[model samples]
Target: MNADFPFRIVGFDLDGTLLDTSGDLAAAVNHALTSVGRPALSVEEVRPMIGGGARHMLAQGMAATGGCTEGELDVLQRRLLDYYAANIADKTQPFPGCLAALDNLTGRGVRLAVVTNKLEHLAREVLDALHLTSRFDAIIGGDTMGPGRGKPAPDPVLAMVQRCGGGSAAFVGDSVYDVQSAQAAGLPVVACSFGFLQQPVETLGAEAVIDHYDELIPTLVRLGSAA
Candidate 1:
């Protein structure tokens, strides 16, 4: 392994790992819930529902508000998406030091990509709205690879490596999906403790855990050393 940086490519989970999008997401979910006469959820309550994507988030929200039929869920899901798209970045911003950490990795010749469970266009819209589109080599979304092939399946991570020119890679994310996918892809992972985690960070099973972006590169360096 090269001592400078063992990985040539680094993949990230978008919603929690890169951006603090819980506020906007909670608003969208509340929009849908209100449309169906259900009560709203707090940002803290909605944060854990986010990792699996909009539909999953809505499902969780509806479950909290007396559940819904497939038909009801479908209508609410579309409403949630439309509301979210229109205000994708109202309160969304990069987690502290994420941009600098990206820059640090880029300076080291490490390519970066986002492997999100968000739908492709929504992810693009959110990134574009935040003016962060140019920072990544690729932004693979939940639907990008068809049904059931998002994170935790290893497919998206494998695709990210290929799209970034097929070298050693690592994944940075906050959820079990992220860690599982990286491990499945034979890569090390770093979990972000500050992210909107559904479970406790200790259960993520990543090679390392970081509380801030300032710790990201150093954690990666240590992972590289161990590799």
Candidate 2:
């Protein structure tokens, strides 16, 4: 282990923070929208609707195109998930410098983990497709904790620490849900400015913000040093 590195473990949120999944996600949302005669939304229009789970994202899309009954939303959500699973990696790639940043952490002997609001199976599928599943010591998904216990609930974040065998840890993410979950788990969080932001990245209340993956190591080092 690198004694100079203060953090022994680091957890990441998958979608926007680790990978740019907007293309496939937007396609899935559009598929559901057009299936019921709703107008298709542009990728830019659908970007902010991500971070939340597929059902929540689809609901926002449904509302944007045209309001839907709960029943319709239920049906459309399944379709969205099914479509997304099949095309999860079509346009998804790690953000610039993401792989390098992860490698730096791993080289320092920092245990890496993924704590995402995405379902376990889907998260696994996407990571496996990208050949990234081997990098993380733990992969905790929204469903891994059970119904109603996803991010913003702190359950998954806590589970990440446990699964990683416990250590001084920190989180990196791109959403309010990520900040809340990490904070609630008593870890400092760094926000990604280039992520799928529903609001200003500064307003997410993370301890620090980085515009690119190249800044990740420095940011985490500063955060750890300050701690």
Q: How does each model score on lDDT?
A: 0.92, 0.93
Residue pairs clashing in model 2 are none
What ranges in model 1 sit over 4 Å off?
A: 1-3
How far out, in Å, is residue 35 in model 1? 0.6
TM-score of 1: 0.98
User: On residues 5-65, what C-alpha lDDT tens digit does candidate 2 reach at each position?
Assistant: 8898999999899999999999999989999999999999999998878888998999997
Residue lDDT tens for model 1, 1-227: 33488889999999999999999999999999998789889999999998998888999999988988989888889999999999999999999999999988888888899999999999999999989999999999999999999988999999999998998899999999999988999999999999999999999888999999999988988898898
User: Which candidate gets the maximum TM-score versus the true structure?
Assistant: 2
Highest lDDT scorer: 2
- Give the Cα error of residue 157 in candidate 1, in Å: 0.6
RMSD of each candidate?
A: 1.2, 0.7
